[model samples]
Every structure is written in structure tokens, then in C-alpha cells.
Target: KEFLQWYIKEQGEEEENSEANVKNIKEAGDDLSAVDEKMGTRGG
Candidate 1:
């Protein structure tokens, strides 16, 4: 039971970290898109 609880906690943390990374990636992509739009390129 103790191991299972620890495993569950670890899994939850991994999921949270994954979500944060994805959000950061999305923000970076948006920044790149904005730059492209400003440059009047295909990203517009």
C-alpha cells in the first residue's frame, strides 16, 4: 500500500510537469508565430 501511494504521487507529479512543459512549448510557438507575422512571412 505504501509503495502504491508513492507511485501514485510520482505519477501525478510527472503529469503536472508534462502539462507545464507543453504549456511552455505552446507559448514559445506563439512567440515565434508573432515574430513571423511581424515579418509578414508564411506564419501570418
Candidate 2:
């Protein structure tokens, strides 16, 4: 019973971490695209 509870807790933490990582990656991609647009404007 104790082992099962610990395992469930660890899995929940891991799932949360994975979700945060995905969100961070998406935000970074958005930032990069914005920077690219800014650079393009400067060139023009």
C-alpha cells in the first residue's frame, strides 16, 4: 500500500513536469518567431 501511494505521487509529479516542459517549449517557439519577424522588419 505504501509503495503504491509513493508510485502514484511520483507519477503525478512527472506528468506535471512534462506538461510544463511542453508549455515552455511552445512559448520559446513563439518568442523565436516574434524575434524573426522583428529582424525581418529591420532588414526591410
Candidate 3:
């Protein structure tokens, strides 16, 4: 029973970390796109 409780808590923490990672990745992609746009304008 104690093992099960610990396992559940660990799973919850893992899920939260996974969600945060996904959010960071999306934000990074957006920033990259903005930079790309600026570079494109400069090139032309």
C-alpha cells in the first residue's frame, strides 16, 4: 500500500514536469519563428 501511494505521487509529479516541458518547447518555437522573420526582412 505504501508503494502504491508513492508510485501515484511520483506519477503526478512526472506529469507536471512533462506539461511544463511541452510549454517551454512551444514558447521556444514561437521565439525562433519571430527571429526567422526578422532575419528574412533583413536579407531582402
Candidate 4:
């Protein structure tokens, strides 16, 4: 039960972060390539 709850919480956090990143990408109009490159660098 404890592990299930922790797993659900982690999933929610990851989903929220993905949502935020999508929003940022959309807002980053006319410069997606630059934004993507920066994100890749940071992720790598």
C-alpha cells in the first residue's frame, strides 16, 4: 500500500512536469529549435 501511494505520487509529479514543459514549448514561439537545443543540453 505504501509503495503504491509513492508510485502514484511520482507519476503525478512527472505528469505535471511534462505539462509545464509543453506549455513552455508552446509559449516559445518562433524559436522552438533554440529552446529544444537548450533543453537537450540541459537534459544531457
Best by the TM-score measure: 3
| Backbone clash tally (model 3) | 0
Each model's lDDT comes to: 0.79, 0.83, 0.83, 0.76
What's the residue-level lDDT of 18 in candidate 4? 62
Tens digit of per-residue lDDT, candidate 3, span 1-44 = 99967765776589987677668778999999999999999997
Supply candidate 4's per-residue lDDT for 12.
64
Off by over 4 Å in 3: 1-13
Best by lDDT: 2
What 10-residue stretch in candidate 3 is worst by lDDT?
4-13
Worst 10 residues of 1 by lDDT: 4-13
- Cα error, candidate 4, residue 6 (Å): 24
TM-score of each: 0.57, 0.63, 0.66, 0.36
Q: Of the candidates numbered 1 and 4, which has the greater TM-score value?
A: 1
C-alpha lDDT (0 to 100) for residue 36 of candidate 4: 85
Worst 10 residues of 4 by lDDT: 21-30
As for TM-score, the candidate ahead, 2 or 3, is 3
Sorted by TM-score, highest first, which candidate order results? 3, 2, 1, 4
TM-score of 4: 0.36
Task: List, residue by residue over 1-44, the lDDT tens digit for candidate 1.
Answer: 99967766776689987677668779999999898788887545
Q: Which sections of candidate 2 miss by over 4 Å?
A: 1-13
Q: What is the lDDT of candidate 2?
A: 0.83
